[model samples]
Target: MLLVPATAATIDRRLTGRSPVDGRPALVLLDLDQVQQPADEVADALARFGAGRFADVRQLAPERPEAPDMDGLSLLSDLMPQVQKALDSGDASQRQALKAEVDAVLASMPEAPAGRDQPRLDGVLKAMSEALAAEDEDAKPS
Candidate 1:
């Protein structure tokens, strides 16, 4: 799952292809320091990616309450060598053990909060423009 900044919310809006006639992503204590990400960019990557171009994408917000899928691909980020060794082991028991360990990581993620409803990106863009205008106003000599 991708964790990105709220500013890129527009990109996510388009990717989900949900109704823009809704609202916005709620302002939560979203933690994105672990990865270099932005909201819109996250959606763009997902929407534009194809098989093998990007690893499988499954998002699980730590703020939510549901158990995420126990998929090894999700844990591949930190256990590539172990995962590879397991896949290459060819021994059923070894492979099952490795896969199970990774699966636990997926199952343990904190759930995301009830998501902010989808909405048109126009308001944010307008707000940005207005903020810029205000900045320019402040910069002018009195």
Candidate 2:
């Protein structure tokens, strides 16, 4: 008789739920490393990051790695149209407003250790591309 390994059970632990604190935007950053980490370790990181800062977080086993809810997906979906406009119009002012929104989302992350590289979030990339293009054009020595 052949023996087969049993599949791992899914874990769905929510550290925090959606919050409306001061009407500011909420952000969730998944600690990808935690997928393989022990529950205690994952809980510690969640506790550290969710102290009135992060709006939601969860740790799921690899067998069932999935987002807890559609809130984040909804946020990205709503922002895509605005991002498209900013990218198409190449408008600095519009990009600035969108950048502020992105900032609010990033404010949920814990302060990085000194000298650590910052993780680039989406939506900001389009603005960064626009800025770099302008710089390149300026340096063309026309």
Candidate 3:
């Protein structure tokens, strides 16, 4: 009936009866570290109780993987503001040049790890594309 973080301190507290839900029955503690997995752990646990109306299940946390190094993408933090400024200026030539520069920077940089920095990179690209698209729309005759 309770979903909690898979940390040593939390497990210790729960095991020592110090948790707020200590006295509650039908407690299921699960730790999922998979990048993709179904959300049926609770349902499976409940099914196992089988008409007992009460059960307690606990799972130890897995070792966490190290975060991917994003040093190569750090320059983006500086470049993004410049890009934004160029977009706001509404100068087609400047925006085009900046886009080329940004594209070159991105191409030279190392690929981001899946499910980590990819989303961030995609987001930046999307923002740039949207700004350029808006600029194009504004240039069109009414």
Residues 18-41 of candidate 2 have per-residue lDDT tens digits of 223332222334445647878566
Task: Count clashing residue pairs in model 2.
Answer: 0
Better of 1 and 2 by lDDT: 2
lDDT of 2: 0.50
For each candidate, the alpha-carbon lDDT, in order, equals: 0.44, 0.50, 0.59
For model 1, residues 5-119, the per-residue Cα lDDT tens digits are 3454444232322211233333222343555787567657656774343322334323353363344234344566655564455555665565555455534644433665322
TM-score, candidate number 2: 0.36
Alpha carbon lDDT at 137, candidate 3: 77
Model 3 superposed RMSD (Cα): 10.8
Better of 2 and 3 by lDDT: 3
**Candidate 1: where is the Cα deviation over 4 Å?**
1-77, 116-142
Model 3, 1-142: lDDT tens digits are 4443434333433442223344432224433444245546554656676445433444433436557447636666777787788888988888778777766655665666676646466567656756765786788799
Cα displacement (angstroms), candidate 2, residue 116, comes to: 18
TM-score of 1: 0.28
Name the best candidate (by TM-score).
Answer: 3
**Top-lDDT candidate index:** 3
